[model samples]
Target: MDIKDGKIKIAYLSQVPAPYRERMHELIHQDHQFSYDVIYCAKLEPNRKWELEYGNYKMHFLTDVAKTFRHNNTNVWALLKKLNPNVLIITAFKPTMLYGVIWCLLNGRKIIVYNDGTFNSEKSISMIQKQIRKFVYWVASSFMAPSKGTNDLYNSYGVGNDKIFRSCLCVDNSVFDNLPVRDREFTIMFSGQIIERKLPLFFANIAIELSKKIPGFKALIIGDGEQREEMIERLKQNNVDFEFTGFLDQKILPKYYSRAKLFLFTTKHDEWGIVANEACASGTPVITSVDAGAANDLIIHNINGYILPINVNIWVEHILKLLGNDNLYNEFSINALAMVAAYNHQQAAGGLVDAVNYALAEKNKSTQSNTITA
Candidate 1:
């Protein structure tokens, strides 16, 4: 992928590709006018996984600077110099991307900031740290926010509404949207890590409660983590009717989604849970914690799914509520599919395209203003 002299050379500085990013890359490649590069971090820390392929796109993987926390890279400057892109998109506020950000700022290139963080989750930063974030916001020509929660945070930092772009934290809806849905039952499915933050114990508790209320209820958990052995042992000891299918790839996840009558996301706190979106797209209703970022935009309490606390009784009650009433289940399923339609790769890629064009257009106006002043 040689950069043409006159083309719109746009480069994305990212940690790595997950399903959402892979979809974005595929869509961005559809446009022939823009020369794009999806740069990557050479490796992730230890056992963490990104679960995406580099594929056929033009990519540059960088050398690591730190061994832990943020995984900053040292190769950003050299890569940016080589690419000399007209627009640079930073996926998060990392020191690694800061090199390219500062270089672009000094060289008069456009910078677009895409972040999924909101005050709702990471709320303990100091005022000084927030001011620094605002400074970054000041220079960024446009922002790509995944949900209303983040967009609100950017606005609080003095970002104008016009400059904010709504990019959904999406899944490949095409894969799950058309899968044949099963007859309504008490079958529940859970996806995501078995880590503590994800509340793997909460999942087991919910399954136990559901079993007590409904005879022959089944719960399928499809993931693995540090607590996998501990959690599985607990589920088995209690004799809960559950199956741990381990970690299934995105391509294989839909089959389980179709088998499920409902989906459970028991995260204590999450910036954005794309699994919730995946569940909705598969026409399976979702019950998520109100603190989950996806809950605000995706779950319509008792309409599509319930947004409740991490209480076992409450979750069990709602699970039974959705299961007992087939009429309500069908309605929620319809709304679930309809709501997830806008948060697909097609719409998300459109938002990115619009953000880039807006940044360039604004820069052009600024240039014209300076010329007129001269």
Candidate 2:
């Protein structure tokens, strides 16, 4: 907690080397204020197709866990023991992170727990699960959150402003900048895995309705998953003109994201849809469901985009309205760019450091109080 000669040794426990998070980690590593190391449970998940680009930073991957989608407590414990960090950052509430929490508790080290979940996404949590989260919240020295929904979630568990820090869930928005202005390609676009929660069939339904009113309604579908075939079949049956680009690399995504007139995110629940961030960064307006975590922070209703319920009729109405009205679409596009400008990698890294510093400061204060009592 004393920062041991001006650098607090920090260890982060994460699920994977997520592309969006890797950049933020690079920025945090560049900061001279703290010694940072990211210990990943795995290199990639079973579903992800990310092309990870590791930076010149301290990164350790659990080899045994990398092969499978599970974490070994022994590996996690051994790594934490070896790191012996002043503060440990836990990125999720899984069993793997629980092991880290227990290690931190036994070692008397400070802990900073990051929360990105919202009540809507966690509606099925049992009472026991809530109690476990409450316990984790109690053990944490500080909390890091990306959106207001996550902040409110922490507040609901009795966390106060003093212990909460803002680390926005962001991507490199600058990448989308400076692309040659070209005519928008697709009338509406949907990006993300074609899984049940993403509601790809619902998007197809919207496309069907829109094609009835608008001439030549073309939809763009990006990414792939178990539901890809079904989604495609539905779209075909509806006679909707569409294109499906299966699981593109991170670098190639900007071209598609930037070309769409309206980015449609009809998800049942998302912690924070990074695709929405990508869409806005590309100067394309978005129409997302209210259940998306980005709806709380990034997409302002009727400003950058519309955050509506999962009603097909309503989605079709808004899509038709935006596509028909050029003035409104342009206004939304401009606003989307302006709104996403604030959430960048730099800001996210700074927020993590702030949370770490706050935790160390609180630990030092507690140490002083104990010393006085003694």
Candidate 3:
């Protein structure tokens, strides 16, 4: 390992160069003790026209010899070998990560994983996939999970407790928190893709019900999707008053979050929801299902918002209750802003730094013990 200018060299392999991940890099670079480079497989999402605002960071791109998430394997070894980091981090167990871990194992590099999945998702895993991931865990040095479900996932795979570090996800909260405040409007908001999995159609139904129950209620749907036409058709049929703001960039979200009285995210299942975090930062109460991993972290039931099972009736009851009670909504709104103080990108990035140091220290102790024996 090489220490240049007394800084620990760390390399991170990212599936995508997200704004949040770039923010994480900035937070990591802020520490004088650490120097980092991010290697990305793709600059943009594959097979999608959804272009995200990119960041200028110390980053590298690998030649994606194959082009797909499930099977794409890029030429990552050359740069990794040259960098020769003290610790290497991969974001998932995909082909690129598999390639990364193999190279790390060959070079005896310490490995930390930031999986995009949670253990409690109940997603069907084939036996081969399970065995493959088990081997992946076997070679990994430490894991950084974003949610409790992810921590449980690592445990289910037999990873030791000492080898796990929480905080797999975070957004740089400064942008959302520092946004110019807006007056609360009689509107409910949902920000995400309009996919079947995201259930924007379900959101349309909720919007219809909400508008009918609450006076002057309007729906603010901020996103684009395959189900956009479907959602619009349903909205028209239900005679719901809604505004479909075509997909806005991350930077543009705070204003939408600011004016909305309540933020509703009705997804089938997600490891975590950054929108919920954004809502919390903007001081808007969140109404998300417990299926979202960020629900528990960002929202205390009936405090910042309500978290119930993905049941439409239950969601309507809680939302109507919040809307009907001005005092309760204000209380939740205030609590939302207060609770997000600890869940920022800097804090999440710091957890990664801790993981790197812990792994390296363990390696150093093992080496010393071996030397003494010799």
Comparing 1 and 2 on TM-score, the stronger one: 2
What C-alpha root-mean-square deviation, in Å, does candidate 2 show against the real structure? Answer: 5.0
The models' CA-based lDDT, in order, is 0.78, 0.82, 0.75
lDDT of 2 by residue, 1-374 (tens): 44556888999998888778877887777777678899988877777778867876899887523555656546788888888899999988767888999998998998899978975676688988898899999989988899988888898888887778788888888788523223766788889999999999898889888878887678899989889999999889888899999999888888788767888988988999999899999988889977899995899999988989889999888887887787887888899999999888777877787777678773533211110000
The C-alpha TM-scores of every prediction are 0.91, 0.93, 0.90
lDDT of 3 at 144: 84
Best of the two (1, 2) by lDDT: 2
List, residue by residue over 1-374, the lDDT tens digit for candidate 3.
66778888888987766665666677676667777888878766554444456554578877533267664555777788788887889987778778888888887888888776777574577888888888888877777877777887888888877777766466655666423223666478888888888888778878888768877777888888789899989988988877888888666776677777788878888888878888888888888877898877667897898888876777788888887787887888889888887776656776786678777884522111110000
Q: How far is candidate 3 from the true structure (C-alpha RMSD, Å)?
A: 5.2
Rank list by TM-score: 2, 1, 3
Clashing pairs in 1: none
Put the candidates in lDDT order, highest first: 2, 1, 3
lDDT of 1 by residue, 1-374 (tens): 23486568899888755667676676776577678898766545455565656555687778533256564676788889888888899887677777778989878888999888875875777777677687888899988888888888888888887888777778767777434445534388878888999998888888877777887788888898998998888878888888788988766787678678888988988888988888888789999887898877877787889999889998888888878887998899999999988787766776777777788883533211110000
Better of 1 and 3 by lDDT: 1
Off by over 4 Å in 3: 47-56, 63-67, 177-182, 363-374
